[model samples]
Target: MVVALARKKIYEEIADIILSEIKSGKLKPGDKLPAITKMAESYQVSQASIREALNSLKVLDVIHVKHGQGSFINEQMPLGFEQNFEIITKADIANLLDLRKIIEVGCVRAACEKAEAHHHERMAEALGKMWTAVENNELGEQADYDFHMAIAVSTGNPLLANLLEDVSETMIRTMKETRRIWLYETEKSIQKIYDEHKLIFEAIKNEDAEAAAKSMYDHLKGVEDVLLTNY
Candidate 1:
């Protein structure tokens, strides 16, 4: 007897179609994708699903959105980048967090060793924005992700930065989950996150690799605990 595969969600199906088009050279680099309405009509899916599919492409760096323009394929995107983003799953949040811990903790350590004054300044700025957002009762998810990306960029490793960027969708999901948990379940949890980020930044600023890695690990562990326990 043969087992049937699970049906793909409409958005996922759209995403796969777009990916296949790109891989087949039907959508070349620097080419702007068709409008959402057009794509929806073509694929016989809702515009919302087409939008989601385009967002997934953005997450994978297969395309970049330009406001007032349209989504254009990344000129420098590597071949087969879509393969890296094919395995989207709701149940993979925990696994994504685990992978994040591995990659980001390593990035923190490397940042401590290799980061320059400008890199430290960038992280500090992102940290400041995060604090401001928390004070304003906003999620500050973008700043949070930027702070982490700064650490990765500080490593001066394009490959590492690309690796982290490739997982942008999952990272954003994890960040939103972190904020949601803190906003609803844990009181004053934003303060705790602020303090953790401060510690991580300071360790990197002081060029303490072990401390940076430990601080990053602890920060991620706290988020992981919240996710695993509540989610």
Candidate 2:
């Protein structure tokens, strides 16, 4: 009964211990985790407890469990989540965007190549909503994110979809900050963003990798330009 009541917390503590190992490179990706019995012994916990912990990690896209083979660490984080106990701050959002760009440009190309009619439909729908939000003269952070997430879904990779959850909060905040600070000075900036998104949507629908990548890059560059011009 005590163990049952403490189950969730125990899972988190055990996961933290293993997650620490993974972050330190002590347990590199593809390195098989210890068997349940060994991990139980090492952690001084029951096998059932260890299993519960592992299951939680699996749901977080943190581990791979194979039939007959032991579980193994996944390479890098699923989307962009997960770090060791390493402290990250609000100031780190810029660096996070850079990292996202580095990894996601490749995904853009892949998605462009494999895009389907339905994918274009999704992006188009989101793009329309974004334009509506733009004309409504307010921040359209959710719509903006939805457009990009549509592209991610087009990649046919659920892992990528799960990975990008709400990562735009920082970007959204920065945009709002920049927007408010420069509302008077930066004329027609929001319209420009909508136009850039249109170009990106068209490129992806056409399955043009170079065009799609370039268009998306240009959109991000426009946002960076706002940062420079306003700040």
Candidate 3:
């Protein structure tokens, strides 16, 4: 009984250790993790404990298991989560969007508090590019990404900025998909995207953290709705 309990506790600890390695970038997407037997030996734990840890990671989408081949880190995996755009299900997309919203809302709130005049200027410039893109019938994904990334940078938080950078592939992918849908399926979605970003910019310019966070949420909520419901 005591050994079983010890194994349980050690498995959880081992899982966290592996997760931390992935988050710290020691382990990367598509990187084949050590074999379970090796991991068990390295961690001084039983193979059962290592197996349990890897199983948990698989459940969280941190790793993919092949029957004969060793487990590999998921390419779509997020930093702590996973920002892979090549998702298999709508639920995966929803999970990514939810996490993106959490990070962005916090960044917007912080940007409102800390962003400088130049930061606001950069966002305005990005918005201008977005407008031009829409007028030209382009997706403007880069500009859209830059605008949000600028907001994260404006917060003066490297961690937040890195998080945004880490999930950029997901952001760009979602932007392209949503833009295409809005253009072909919905009307005035281009304008709506511009308007939403404008709201976020205005709130930041006015230094209203609460308002900025809300606008960001509303903007993202719209994207989530379109993708999940319409697309």
Candidate 4:
């Protein structure tokens, strides 16, 4: 008797197939991928699913996309990154969120008192980038992280900033997963998350420490709730 494999999302399955090809040396580095339409036909999935898989691979730096050209495998793949991506469990995400809440909530509260003009400007810039990315139908994970990082920097505590920076990679991965899930769930979900960020920024700008803390907690809690429930 053989045990059946666990079911994965269609896009994830497609991504895994592509990664296997790469690992097996069938898809060499810097080699162009087949056209999305062709890959869709080959896999018997929609073109949209192929696109999603390609985008996920791109995020992992396994592939690089050139505008108006095509996607190609990265010349130098990050060692062990795929293993890291595959092993991230819900429990890991939950713990990451818990850590974020503890650090970020405190950081925002301190930012309300210590933040300067430059820090606010950086936060605003990050927010602008996030809005633009959303409008362009891209995941603005970097911008989202930048916004929180700005809060951390504004706290006048180098230790707090260092701690956040140390976990930046994991945070980016989780953010990508969270945003991907939101995009798949509803068109409005990403916008709601952006709104939550805006609320937190507003509280910080107004120097309302209590409100800042509450907004940050609520935003992260909302994320935790969605991720835990869905994944």
Per-residue alpha-carbon lDDT of model 3 for 71-151, expressed as tens digits? 899888644363321322356558878998899999999998899999999999999999999899888978999999999
Q: Ten-residue segment with the worst summed lDDT in candidate 1?
A: 82-91
Give one digit per residue, the lDDT tens place, for model 1 in 87-182: 444356678788888999999888988999999899999999999987898878789999989999999999888988988867875686578568
- Where model 4 places Cα greater than 4 Å from the true spot, the runs are 1-22, 25-86
Best by lDDT: 4
How many clashing pairs does model 3 include?
A: 5
Kindly indicate the candidate among 2 and 3 with the higher TM-score. Answer: 3
Leading candidate by TM-score: 4
Report lDDT per candidate.
Answer: 0.80, 0.69, 0.81, 0.85
TM-score of each: 0.63, 0.55, 0.62, 0.68
**Selected candidate, larger TM-score, 1 vs 4:** 4
Q: Model 3's lDDT to the true fold? A: 0.81
Report how far off residue 190 is in candidate 4 (Å). Answer: 0.8
1-231 per-residue lDDT for model 4 (tens digits): 999998898888898888888888998989999999999999999998888788667656587666678889989986685573553455667899999999999999999999999999999999999999789878798999999999999999999999999889878876866786677554456877789899999999999999999999999998898767755
